[model samples]
Target: MKKIYCLIYILFTLPLLSQEKEGITHSGQLTGNPPFPIENYSELDNPKSTSETLWNKKNRTFVSWANTDVRYNKEIPAPIALSQETLHLSAWKGEQLNAQLIISAHRKSLELNFEISDLSSSQSKIESKNITGGFVRYVMTDELNKDGKGACGPRNHKEFDSTLVADPIDHLNDRLSIAKNTTRPVWVTINVPRDITKGKYTGEIKIRDGDRILKKLGLEIEVLDRVLPKSENWKFHLDLWQNPYAAARYYRTDLWSDEHFAAMKQDLQHYVNAGGKSITASIMNRPWNGQTYDPFQSMVTWRKTIDNKWSFDFTVFDKWVEFMMDLGVKKQINCYSMVPWRLAFEYFDEASNSMKTIETKPGEKAYSEMWGAMLKAFATHLKKKGWFGKTYISMDERPMDVMLETIKLIKSADKNFKISFAGSFHKELLERIDDYCLALGENYPQEILGKRQNRGKISTFYTSCAHPRPNSFTFSPPAETAWYGWYAAATGLDGYLRWAYASWPLEPLLDSRFSTWAAGDTYLVYPGGRTSIRFQKLLEGIQAYEKIKLLRREFIESGEKEDLKKLDTLLNGFASSEIIEKDVAQSIKKANIQLNSF
Candidate 1:
C-alpha cells in the first residue's frame, strides 16, 4: 500500500499557516474513521530547524473520544471533533477512568512535558497523584479481514495479513522521541480514591513544549456518593488463560526458574489489577497442540514405574498454584484438558527407560486407564493441598462426542471433580459443567441461567477470531472493550472469558502478528506488564459492570422504580446483536448520561 495525501485538505489550510501560535495541534488516528480534521499547520510554523519539518503539515483534531488506531505514514482518522474545552468526567469512589492527549510532531520533532494539578472540593481535595499519565507508543499490528472460523491452525492464513498495518496504543512510556510528521499520544488516567468526598473536584492538565505550554485542557471530576468496590471484591469471573511458556521464552529464562516467575509476575500484575479470578493450569504437554508461538508444557509431569503403576509429580503444579494464589487470582484453578485438540498423550516409560507418547481416544481402554490414574492422583494431591474444591478440569472448543466421553471419564474417576467448558452451548451438559462460557453470538438460555445460579455455577461468554466487532483485536476500536460490559449487562451474564492473556508472540510489544490467530489476538496486555489501550478499556468495561451492578442493587433497595426501569430499558438495547454492528461509543455515552443523572 502507498501513503495517500489529502490534496484538497492541504489546499484549504495552506493560506491559514500563521494561526498556529494561537494553539497547539498534531495528527494521527487512522482510515475507516470519519475525516474531520479541524486544525492544520504549514512549514511557516517551523522555529526549530534542529528537527525535521515538512513544507505541508498533516491535520489534527481535538476529539471528545478516541476509539481508533493512531497510525504513522497512514491517513489520519477523523475524530469526534471538539474545540479545546473542559473534559467533564464522573466516577464512583475507587473507579479509574482513562483518556488520551495526542500531540503529533506535525511541523517538526518536539519535546513535551506534562503536569496535572490537584483538584479541590469544598469538603476535601484530590491530590495530583490521583491524576497520572504517560506518553503512548505505537506498535505494529496485523489485521484480519475475516474470522478464519476460529481454527487452531498454522500461520499464513489467506484471510489475514502477515504484514503490520495498524499501530494501536500498545505501550505506555514516560518519554518519547518523535520524528517528523509522526504523532505521539499521552495516556491520561484519573484514579478516584475510595475515601474521596462526594463532591465535584476541579483540575487541569498542562502539556508543555520546551518552556512554553503547548496545550491545557480543563478536568472536572464528579466523585459520586457511591463507591465501586476494589478489584479484589469484584464478582466478575474474568478468566484469561496464562501461558507461562511465553513468559519464559520472552525473558530467556529457564522454565519455572526464579527469574521466570519474576518476569511472569510483572505481567500477571496487570491481570490481577483487572479483577482476575482464575489461574490457568495445564495438566498435559502442549495442551492446545502448539496453536500459540510458545508451547504450553504441563505443570504435572507423568511417570510410570517398571511395575506398570502410574505416578504424578506435582512440584511444578504446586509452585504454579501457589504463585498465582499469592498474586491474588485465587478463586479458581482451571486445569486444561481431559481432552486436548489431539488425543496423543505422553509419559515416562520406566520399562523402556525413555520418554514415550501414546495416541488414544477418551472411551478406549488405553485412554481411560491413563487418564483415570492421573485424575485419581490429581484429586488426592488437590485434596492434600486444599485445592480440591476450586480445581476444574477445563476443555476448549471440542466436539460433542469428545466432550461427552471426556466428561464421563472425569465423573467415573471422581464425581467430586469440577469441570469448566468454553465452546458452543450444549443443553445436555448444562447440569454437568460448573463453569460454562458460551462464545459470542451463541445465546445461553436465560431461564436455565437461574438454575445454574442457584446451583452456584458460572455462565459467561467469550469471543475469538469468529467475532469481529466489539472484540479486542489490536485494530479494533478502543471503546469495544467497554462495550463488552454493556453486552454482559444486556444478557445478564456473570463475566467474560478470553483464551489468551499473555500468550505473547515472538515480538508482542513491536509486532503483534502471530502466524496462527489474528494479529494481537493472542494477548491483551503487553510484555513487561504494560497495559494497552484495549486492556485499559477492558478494565473500564469491568468497572462499568461493577458500577452498573451496584447501581441496580441500590435502586432496588431504595424503590427507585422509574430510574431502575429506565436503566434496564437502556441496557435492553444491547440485547440485540445489532448494537455491536453500530458505533458503540455513541450508545455507551448516551447511556452514561442517564446513569450519571441518578
Candidate 2:
C-alpha cells in the first residue's frame, strides 16, 4: 500500500511542478499627482481591465517621450511634454535573467529616476542584477529645423513599437523616438530585474522645468497563474485600392476592364468562397485636383459645414463598391480611413510652375475633422441602407485627442458602428476606447516572425511572394514562410494584405527593368496564360495545410499523441529529404514528377 501511494504522489506532483516553473506574467500602470486636469487619464492604461479607472487627478499632465519643449532640429527633437505638475509610480516583472529596455533618443539633458516597490518588504530578497542604474540620452545638433530653432531629429520614418514576446528577427527597428529639438536629445535606459515578480513598481522623470510631473506612470504586478490570450480572433480588413496610380495601372486599364469585370468579380467571389470575410473600401477624393486632373504634384484640402458635417464626391468610389456587392462578392465592409489625403488647392493649375497651401477660414475644423465627419456620414448612409452592424469605421496615426473626439462622433451618429485603427499609434488610445485594430506586419516583423499565433488577416507587409532569383524572393526557407501562414491561422488573423496579387508578367518595371528584382516579386501573376494556375496551386496547398491544422487541433483537444504523430508523419512525407534532396543533374526527372502532382 505504501509503495503504491508513493507512485501516485510522484505522478500527480510532477506536472504541477513543471507548470509552476514555466508560468510567468507581466503588467504595469501609469499614474501621477493631482491638480492639472487629466483630460483622459484612463488612456494611459489597458482598457480591458475590469476595475479600470477613468481620467482622474493621478493622470493630470500627460507627458513623456512624445511632447517636449526643445526646439525642433534635424538631429534632435523636443522631449515628450505634459501639462501636469506631479510625480508618479509604475511596476513590472524581470522574468528570466535576460531582459533589458534599450532607450536611445536624442538629448542628454533629460534624466530618469526609478524605484522598486518591495511588496514583501524583505531586503535580503531584493535582486541586484535586475536593476539598471541610469538612463542615457543622445544629443545631435547638426540637423536643425528650417527656422534653425530646434533639432529635427532625423525622421526615423521607420516608426513602430515591438513587444518583448514577438519574433526578434522580424523587428527591423527599435523603440527609439525622434527628437525635434537640437538642445534636448535625452535617451534613457533602465536595467530591469532578471526574475522579479508580483510586486509594485514606480518611476518618475522630469523635463527641464521640473515643476510639472510627466504623466504619472505606475504598474502593479501580480504574477497570475495563467496569462490571457493576446487577441480575440483574426480580423479581416478589405479596402478598395484607392490609389489612382495603382487603379489606373492595374484594375482600370484597357486590357483588364476591356476583357471583363469577370476577373475582378471572380477574385472577390473566390476569396469569399474560401471562407474570407470583411472588406474596407475608402471614399478618398481623386488624388489630383478635380479641375487639373494631374496624377502627380497634388496636396490635400478640407471643407466643413455649420452642423459640423462634411461631404465628398463619392460617385466614382460608390460605383466600384456597388459593383462588387451587386456581383455577390459577399463580405462585410469596414469603411477605413474616410479621409486619406489633403486635397490640392482648387485654383491650382497643373500647367502652373508652382503650388501653395489653401488657407482655411477661421473657426473651421481641420482637414482631419472633416474626414471624421465623412466617416460618420458614410456610416449613417450604410446604416440607412441596412448595413449598420455590418460595417465599421477607423482612423490611423492621429493624435489621441482626435481619436477620442472621432469615436464620440462615430458613436453619436451610429451606436452599433465598430471603430478601430492600426495598433501602431498612441497607448492612450488603447486605454480610451474598445477600438480594434490590425497590427502592421511590416512595421514590427520581430513581433510576428516565428511566434505562434502572432499574426492574422488585415496585417500589412512587403513580402517577396512567389518570384524567382536573388531579387525575386526573400530566399527564406519554406518552413519560415509556412510558419507565417500557420501562425496567422492559429492567432485568428482575419486576412493577409499585400500590395498586389496578380499584377501579371515577370518583367522588370520598377527596380531592374527587364532583369528581375526581389522587391518586385510579390505579384501572383505569372507571365504565361497560366497566371491563375500557379496561384491556384499555392492556394490549394494552403487550404490543405489548413486542413492539417484542423486535424492537429482535434488531436490536441483529444490528447491523442498517436493521432498527432500520424499527422506529423504525413506532413513530413510531403516534404521529405528523399523527395527534395535529389542531385540537380538528375533531379529534373523527380522535379517533373513532383510538379505534375501539384
Candidate 3:
C-alpha cells in the first residue's frame, strides 16, 4: 500500500519539478523581456498536469551536453548523464552552421549565463561576431494534433506533448533561470567565411553563471577542402513561403511601417542565410482563404476603371520584391497564386468605390476575363522591373480540371509567362508548367524530370498537412528536418518547399499551436529574428544537400568512379519512404557518418 502511494507521488511530482518558469510567458522578445502584449495564453501552460515520461529517477542538479537533434522537454529529467561532449562539425565555406548544448539543473533552480570563444584555424580566425550564442526557449504544446486530413501517432515526441517544449533559440545576453530538474539548451551558431582558409578549426563554448564557469565543451570543425558556393549561388532551390503581415501583427507595428520592415528584415535575413531562393509574393487577396493567421493580402491592387480598362498598383509588389532581392533572395519571385483554393476574386470596383469579391470558379467566362487582364498587366509590370525572366506565377493545391483552364488562361494572357504549382501530382499540366512541386511520396517520372532538367525547368517536392513524417511540424523529430535534404537528393529533386515560414500565431514566442495543424507547423523561427532548433537542423540537411552536389560534381570531373558510386549509394538509401521513426533515425545517422568521412 505504501509503495503504491509513493509511486503515484513520484509520477505526479516529476513533471511539476521541471517547469520553474512553467506558466511564465511574458518574455517574447529576443531581448528576453516581454514575449508579447498577452502575458499568458492559458494554454501556454497545461491546464491539466501531463506526464512527460512513464518513469524516472531522482538525481542531483547537474549540467550536460546534448546534440541539436535531441529535443529535451522541461517536464522530464535529462535523459542522459553526459556532463560534457565534443561538438564535431563540418561546413563548406560561406555556409552558416549551428549546434546545440544542454545544461541540466536536476531538482534545483539556477540562474545562468553563457559565452562562446572564437574559432581559430592555424591559418585564420573567426571572430566572436561571426559566432553567436543563444539559449533555447520553451513553448507549450498543449495538444497533439490529429490533423483533419490525416496524421500518424501523436506518440512520445515531446514537441507533441502537452507540456513545456523547448524550441525557440533565444537571443543571448539576458540571464535566465532554469526550473528545478529542468533542462536549458544553449545554441551556438557559426558563420564560416567564404574566403577563409580550408583546414581544421577549434573553439570552446563556455557555460557560466556570471563569472564562474560551469562547463566548457570542445568544438571542432573541419572546413572541407571543397568550397561551397555562396547561398546566392547555390543551385538547390529553397522556397519557404513568407507572410509579412504576421511580423507586423506580432511586433505591434503598423503594416509596411519602417518598424515593420526593420522587424521583418531580421527574420528574412535568416531565411536568406538558409539559402531561400524564392520570394513568396501574393498576387490575389486571401490566396488560400484565410489559411493563415494573417491575411496574405494581394500585393498588387487590381482595379477596373470606369472606362473599363484594367490598371494595377504595383507599389506594394515592387517594394516587396525589391526588398527581398536587395536582401539576397534574387533567384525567383514565386507569386502565389492564380488558382486559389476558393475562386473568390477580389478587386477594387471603380463603380462601387469599394473593394469587392467576386465568387467565380475557373473555366467560367467571368474568371477568364478577370484573371486575363490581371496577368497581362502583371507581366508588363514585371518586365518593367527586369523581373519577368525570374518571376513564376505560382499556385498551391488546386484541382487538375481547374489547372487546365487556368494554364490556358495564363498562356493566353502572356505566352512567356512561367507557371508554378505545388500540390498533388499533375501529369497533364507537366508540359505547360515551368516549376512543378509534388507532395512527398509522390514521384515525378524519370522521363519527365529528364526533359525538365534539359529545359532548365525545376522539379521539386513539398510536405504539407498530408505528409505524416519527414515534415517540419514543430513536434516532428529533428532527424526529419535533415531527412528532407537527403530525400531530395536521393530522388534527384531540384529543391524543396515549406509554405509556412512565418505564419505565426498571436504570440508565437509563447505558443506554437493552432486549431487545425500540429504545434510549430504555422512557423519555423520565432519573432525578433530568432531561429528555432527545427530551423537549425533544417540547415544541417540543406548543407548536406550542397555538399553532396559539390562532391558528386567533383567526383565526376576527377573521374573518381569508386567514390562516386559510394556517394550515390548513400543517397539512394534515403530514397525510401522515410515516414517511419526508427528507419529515418537510422538512415540519418548512417548518412551523417558516411558524409563526414567523404
Candidate 4:
C-alpha cells in the first residue's frame, strides 16, 4: 500500500512542476519582476573605473556615451573613450523632458541592466510614478563597398546612407545587444506632471551585468514653475500623413480588424500627444499615387447605375470619422484628391450587379463627370456630419492647369468648398487655394504668406527627397528637427507638413531604405509599435517653438518692448544658421532665464 501511494503522489505533482517550469502554473498570472529593476539612483559612477574589462579596446567592445542637447551624425559609431558622465536636463511643468544616452560598442556584445532611484532630497521627493524608462534601437552606418552597395541598399546620398542590419533587440523593452563594436542610442523621457513641485530634482542611473554594476550615471532635472499649457494653441500647424492601410499590411491584419484599429489608435494618440493638430483622411481610392504597398482604403465607396448616376456608401466613412473625433483630430480633416494622379478608380455598377473600372486622363469628360459627382456627395456628407467647416478638398503635387481644372470641378459641386493643395510655387493660384503646402526651398511671395497668415490658412512647407538639410532622420542631427519650429517662427510661416509619417518600407523596423526616396524619407516612426529617436527630437523642437511663443506673448503682454525685441533677434539669428541645433537650446535657455527674471 505504501508503494502504490508513493507512485500516485509522484504522478500528481509532476504535471504541476512542469507547468511552473514553463511559466504557466496559473493562467494569466505573471512570474515575477524582470531580470533587473528599473528605478532612479542617487549616484553616478563607472563600476570598472581602472579595469578595461567593461569594454575591450582591442576587440572593439569599448563603449562611449554622452547626453547632448541635440543629436547630429548620431548614426556614426563613437570612439572608444568615455565621453560624458552625467545627464543634465530641464523642462517646465506639464512637459515631457527628453534626454538620450548614446552607447557605442565595438566588436563585442554586452548585456546591460538599468535602474533609477526616485529623485528626492530633504525638502521634496518625486516618486518613480512620474518617471518612465524606454529605449529605441539605433542603426549604425556601415562601410560601403566600392560599388556603393550596403546592407540597406545602394548609397544614393552620402549623408543619409546606413549600413547597420536591422535587429529586433535594438527596439525598446527588449534585451539590448551591440553587434561587434557598433553604437546604439537609448532614449529616456521624464514626463513632469503639472502638479509636481517645481524645483531641481537629482538622481542616478545604474547599469549593470547581473550583480556586477557597470556604470552609475547622474541625472539632474530642473522643473520650472511656469506650466506649458496642453491646449492646442500652437502657432505651427503640422500634418504628418497617417497611413492606416500600410500599418495593417505591415502587421498582417484585415483593415477592419480590432488589432489594426487598436494599433492605429495608439499611433494617432502618440502623434496628437506630441502637438500634431491636422488629420489626413482619404476620400477616394488612394493618396500619393499609390506610392505605398496597399491601396489607401477609402472611407467612402461608390456605386453606379446603368444611367451613369452615382450613389455612395458611408459605413466605413462614419466609423473613421467617429474614431478620429474620439482621438481629438477635429482641427482639420484633409480629404485627398478630387483628381488623384492617373485618375484611375473602380466602382460598383448597381444596374449590372458587377464592379466596373475607369481610367481617364486629366480633363476627360468621364473624369470630370465622375469627380464632380463624388465631390458633390462628399461636400453634402461633410455638411451632414458637421465637418464641412474644417474639411479641405485636397490635391497633391499636380500641374497648375490640372489643379485649376480640379478646383473648377469642385466648385461646380459646391461653390463654398475649401480647397487645399501641396504643389509647386504658383503665384497665380495663391488666392484660389485655401491651404498651400509648398516645398521648403520654394520662394513664398510675401503677399501669399501674409494673406495666409492673416486669414489663418495653412501656409506650410514640406520636405522629402528634394532637400537634405534640416531633415528628420537617424543620420541627421537632432537640431535639424528643432529648427523646423524655430524656422517657422522666424519666417512667419503658420505650419509644417511631411508627406509620410508611417509609410513603412519592406523591413521598416530594421531598415528604412526605399527604392526611390532617401532611406528615412518614407517614414518618421517605426512599425511593430516603436517610436524613433528622430520622432522624439521632432517633439523637442516643437516644444521649443512653443516655449519661444509663450515667452514672446508674455513679453508683449507685459509691455516689455526691449525683451520682446531681444527674443525676436535671438530667433532671427538662430534661423539664419545652416546648423542651428548646437546653439538653439542654449539661446532658448538664456531667453527663458531673461523672461523669468522679468
Best by TM-score: 3
For each candidate, what is the lDDT?
0.72, 0.31, 0.75, 0.63
List runs of model 3 lying over 4 Å from the truth: 1-60, 142-161
Q: For candidate 2, what is the total of clashing residue pairs?
A: 81
By summed lDDT, the worst window of 10 consecutive residues in model 1 runs over 36-45
Clashes of each: 2, 81, 5, 18
> Residue by residue across 242-273, what tens digits does model 4's lDDT show?
88877776565688677778767755766777
Q: TM-score each candidate.
A: 0.86, 0.39, 0.88, 0.81
Model 1 over residues 1-598: C-alpha lDDT tens digits? 0011222222222232233233211111122211211111111121123323232433442222233223222223223253445777888889887876666455555566678899888889889888777655545555655453342334443444433333334333444445545545667788889998899999888876656676777888898888888899997889988999988866768999999898888789988988999999999988777666677888998999999989999999999999999999989999988787777888999999999998999889999999999999999889999999999999988778889999999998899999999998999989889999988888887889988988999999988876666678776777787778778887889999998898876546555655555567888877656678788888887887887888899889999998899889988867765444355777777877777676
Stronger candidate by lDDT (2 vs 3):
3
What C-alpha lDDT, on a 0 to 100 scale, does residue 211 get in candidate 3? 76
Candidate 3 structure, TM-score to reference: 0.88
Error of 4 at 123 (Å): 4.8
Give the clashing pairs for model 1.
Answer: 30-77, 155-515
The model with the greater TM-score, 3 or 4, is 3
